[model samples]
Target: MSDAPKAANPTGADPEANQPGLGDLRVIVANHLKRRLPGRSTMREDVAAGMSIAVGNVPDGMANGFLVGVNPIHGLYATIMGPIVGGALSSTQLMVITTTAAASLTASQPLADMPVEARTGALFVMVVLAGLFQLLFAVLGLARLTRFVSYSVTTGFLTGIAVLLILSQLPTIAGYPVLGANRVMQTLDLMVHIQEVNPAALGLAVMTIALARWLPRTPLRGFGRLVAIIIPSLIVALFHIDGVQLVRDLGEIGRSMPTPDMPSMLRLAPGVLTGALSIAAVVT
Candidate 1:
């Protein structure tokens, strides 16, 4: 026999040849699941981190849900279920799945036309459809399409989203009703009604914003956002700030855990499709 070792398989074949039919798919699935599983050594740390993230994310999720005109409890539900399901299936340990301002804003547009009572069902459909589209994209290997989007375009898009988020929340922050369907009209309406702004509400908003910004610089930074929201809210309540609205004013928050149910597919309309696509695009 020659001293030299046999040449390696150019096709990356196993030395012990096995059946190629279902074995390849099985290997793929096994590898996927393996990546998703937490290692025994890191289990404690993983659980701690997950708990921290879940708690830290609740306020933002609730805000997004409110902005989307849904019951605030829906936001809490989205935050809880999303991370658990996403964490279990995702390959990356650090990947977080939660409601975002952009997704909520995009979803709100199409939902604007629906009756207040029916908006919740429409929101559910939009979210489900968006998830389905994402799965379709993954199966079709369309992730590479993102490469065609230029960096400048992405920056501008994100900047626009940030502006929209600020504008959308301005009414709430200023203690006024969201005046118009479009941002331009809303801005104009806000300007026209500038004198009607509630002083107490504005002060609370200012205090919350200031604390939220400054608290992170302190030693207790981990709880900055939560404290920022809670302290201002407590002060407002204690002082009995007149003309200031609280979350309790919106509707009764559901106390129980959310259960899964099918969305009303019969209500799907052309506008709903457009909104679903917009949400998926923003999420991606």
Candidate 2:
């Protein structure tokens, strides 16, 4: 045949021009099935995992923010983001992901000295630095080093966190913001001022914790945490109980979507730099 320029693809795409035939297509799909999608035969597993995480964690996510002396909304964001980002990375075990509460607790340590107004911005920069450290660690293949950390040490560390968490929460549960040098002292002050505890708040807190404990044993176990969170809220709304402080009191919730913004390096650096390294190490 006489040589002539081949017709351009209708979409002006090279991919369409050299389209593979059925045999080649089968080979490509087979390879993909065998390699990239070996365990994930369908989207159902991912959907179920997402639902489980959201339902189980959202309430605690709000509380986790208080773990670090910030707005519960910030903890709420971290709780939501942890799974979405960590899962996208194909992390080995979703159940073991403690980045939401534990990491926030760790991050709080460095920001404790910063002014309340400056803390949010400084926290954002520290998050960026922490993410960078995670990437650096992965690239350096330092993840394997964590396997050597002793089990007793790990248990002790987590036990300490749990105790601290309980101590930190006593003030909120009792509706008395006690002041002291540490959580232990705050807890002691709370005990001393036990009579100042708001009856309605204390009752609601007890009810919520009871439900959280009791719900897990029932047939509706999957939604236990969600139910535990909602029941107390409904009771407060229905009764118009004034003693208990609602989450809305902490800050106004935005109705609009968030806009992306660059962190102010100059303004935040001084406040965050000292804590950045520590946060980065913990996060990594």
Candidate 3:
């Protein structure tokens, strides 16, 4: 009763005492939920940041979608849904989830065998299965598996992907038909048809690459990639650069949001499963 402060519930006898039990677990979970919830003061800033990221990522997403043999608008859809869902559920605040070149490239292999009409459905099934696999891995606490992936192996894999990207774009850059059956054959075809390369398209490609490389070093670094894409595009439009291709040349871009559709279960074949696993590995 004196200055001892009643021993501060030392015996843990008080019903209201904080104890390690279901109530404590609830408090822990609530605290985690609170941290994830956006605060009123930062909500506006969060919206602005999300919008900026969405805008900035569109070009890359389109490029990835093109590589995957899908309509480029599908890339934008992937970009939009990925960031929104990923940002909401991820524990890390700064992670940006979006379509990647590696995933697109990997997905193309298994899908290469599918007919033109069936490819889209197959791709959808592959993505859904990949997502389910990822959820399973998370539940199994298998994230540590990535730690075993050697740095050299990763570097080699990325370098190969970069070479593939460059090879795949060669036809577009040179204004040639995408004539090859595989990347190796494509390179051979491009080499044999080197004399037929379109000067205007090649020039644009060179200029875009140069700008993409140099602009990032200047004070306007933040807008480097965007400027690289936009300036060349504007010049192509204004000058009517013949033989240069645009995404619209390929197919009609969907103007509205994509509606969710159920993927065909029959399309989830062994080949698609393999491709989905490959995509998930690269994405992870």
lDDT of 3 by residue, 106-162 (tens): 998998777766777888989988888888888988886865677689999999999
How does each model score on lDDT? 0.77, 0.71, 0.78
Name the lDDT value of residue 202 in candidate 2: 86
lDDT digits (tens) for residues 6-123 of candidate 1: 4333235643224334344444444554454457999999777766676667778788888888777788888888877886666544346777887888898888777777788888
Worst 10 residues of 2 by lDDT: 8-17
Better of 1 and 3 by TM-score: 1
Model 1: CA > 4 A from native: 1-44, 267-269
- For model 3, the superposed segments whose C-alpha errors exceed 4 Å read 1-52, 217-220, 263-270
| C-alpha TM-scores of all predictions | 0.82, 0.77, 0.79
Q: Mind sharing the TM-score for model 2?
A: 0.77
- What is the Cα-based lDDT of residue 281 in candidate 2? 68
Using lDDT, rank the candidates from best to worst.
Answer: 3, 1, 2
Across residues 1-284, which tens digit of lDDT does each residue of candidate 2 receive?
97985432233343432433524443443344234543656688867766776788777777777667666777667766666776555423313354455677777877676666667677777888777877888899987686566668878988987887777778989999888977788898998998899988889999999999999789767688899989999999998999788888876666653455666677664646656666666555
